[model samples]
Target: MCVCTNRFLRLLIEKLCLPTYCLVDCDPYGFDILTTYRFGSMQMAYDAKQLRCPEVCWLGVFPSDSEKYCLPQQCFLPLTAEDKKKAEAMLNRCYLQREVPRWRLELELMLQRGVKFEIEALSVHSLSFLSKEYITSKIQGGVRI
Candidate 1:
């Protein structure tokens, strides 16, 4: 992984005008990373700036998605007390479970078939096309792509 310090990430964000990306990893770790990013404590992204808190958005991680995609036998870390409570709180929130879930489901399907897909899995042509489509769609929707 090309992990960077929070300070470096902060500088990169400022210097390179990088998107405030919130990655959707496996649920438990994903949440931990999100917390670290918000707190600017991640050893990775060590240079990530806390100039101002970036908007932390949750991608979907619904129970239904979990049911369909999660590998029951996979070893998963137990949630921290805070994480458990936060997850519960999220469940109580309106529109509980949001985008991560879909991605997770896609990942799970790939895993079940013994296939691996990474960000770089996209072909150059596909990447450019999708990027253009994504940006266009975002613009049309008045959302940051």
Candidate 2:
């Protein structure tokens, strides 16, 4: 949300043609944040081209990750009515269907499963597990989407 940071990042990405990755919680708000980074805010439509990071990749804390990583039961949080509604609404967005159908399917799967988790949930294993294993493996293995 910091304009300075976004401007700096945008300049860096432009000059270097950097590949960007986004890691957010597996929740509607988190998803919104990721989209904001990739698509830019509707409020700032005037400067979207300067701010948006089109090459950004979704990096972690996907919904299916709960079962895949075997996060403890304590880490799973049931989606509220608001959460379900938000996810369902997002599912209808054309960008998801056209540009990232796999991402949309994962979002749909999240709604069907009725659960959410945070990046911190990965810490249930250990701090190093994220940097050393999950992130390293996902990036190296090209599993990020």
Candidate 3:
């Protein structure tokens, strides 16, 4: 698993060539990821051109996730009003289930069930996927091939 800032993450996203979708936990943090990936750095990238426009979208936002997961204090960064609203909406989404917490449900379930199904879990069966393109779409579609 790779963890990085929006700038570094944007590089990986632009490398991918696919119809990308962003699946994040339904919380302030997750919404921030979407916002960053879509709107560009809310603070840092202000001086530079935005990497890409929003092409990525949220996949699932599980309410059970909030109850089950514990966000690290550092990751619990502040959120704008819009971020909170979006997170709430995502949590209430009908498509998402409380089957697992959004933050670590996949990992917890794998241990409980002895099987792991990650987006990367399908890498073997699927063609290669690029993280850069994934972010590009969500950040902005202005990226030229």
Candidate 4:
């Protein structure tokens, strides 16, 4: 985790008392980053409780979004062998099952789809597609799992 992200998370969770939402690529590495934000990394396990943001929720660029929003097929990338291995390892983490099983399901869906896409892919429609449309629609429709 970057020190800036850690500091910002701390500020958001501790000082602001606000819920955090993550918007990341629909891929193994992105899922890992989400887990780190919610559960804290093992390397810093000793301070996990304070660093972890239990109120954080995953907000989009889900595998299903490719079809939902009509994003161009060219924007999607095939998952590599390393992506699969990392995703499988993440699927086995106890915290996922115990704390947020819904998130695990999404990861499983990504593996099943065997594809990944960046948030920027939404820009295929327009520059503000992500902020002005995709995110607004998802939030308004209660799409977050």
The 0-to-1 C-alpha lDDT of every candidate, in the order given, reads: 0.42, 0.84, 0.42, 0.86
lDDT (Cα, tens digit) per residue for candidate 4, span 1-145: 8746776887878888986778999999888888898889878998887777777788877887788889788998999999999999999999899988888888899999888999999899999988998888877887775
TM-score of 1: 0.36
Question: Can you rank all candidates by lDDT, best first?
Answer: 4, 2, 3, 1
How many collisions per candidate? 21, 0, 19, 0
Candidate that beats the other on TM-score, 1 or 3, i.e. the better one: 1
Model 2, global lDDT: 0.84
CA shift of 140, model 3, Å: 23
Relative to the true structure, candidate 4 reaches a TM of 0.91
Q: Which whole-number lDDT from 0 to 100 does residue 34 have in model 3?
A: 55
Model 3, range 81-140, lDDT digits (tens) per residue? 665455555455332344223434433332233221223322232344324433345347
All candidates: TM-score: 0.36, 0.91, 0.35, 0.91
Q: Which run of 10 residues does model 2 get worst, by summed lDDT? A: 1-10
Query: Runs in model 1 with CA error above 4 Å?
Result: 1-4, 42-145
* lDDT at 31, model 1: 46
RMSD of each predicted structure: 9.7, 1.4, 13.1, 1.5
Clashes of 1: 21
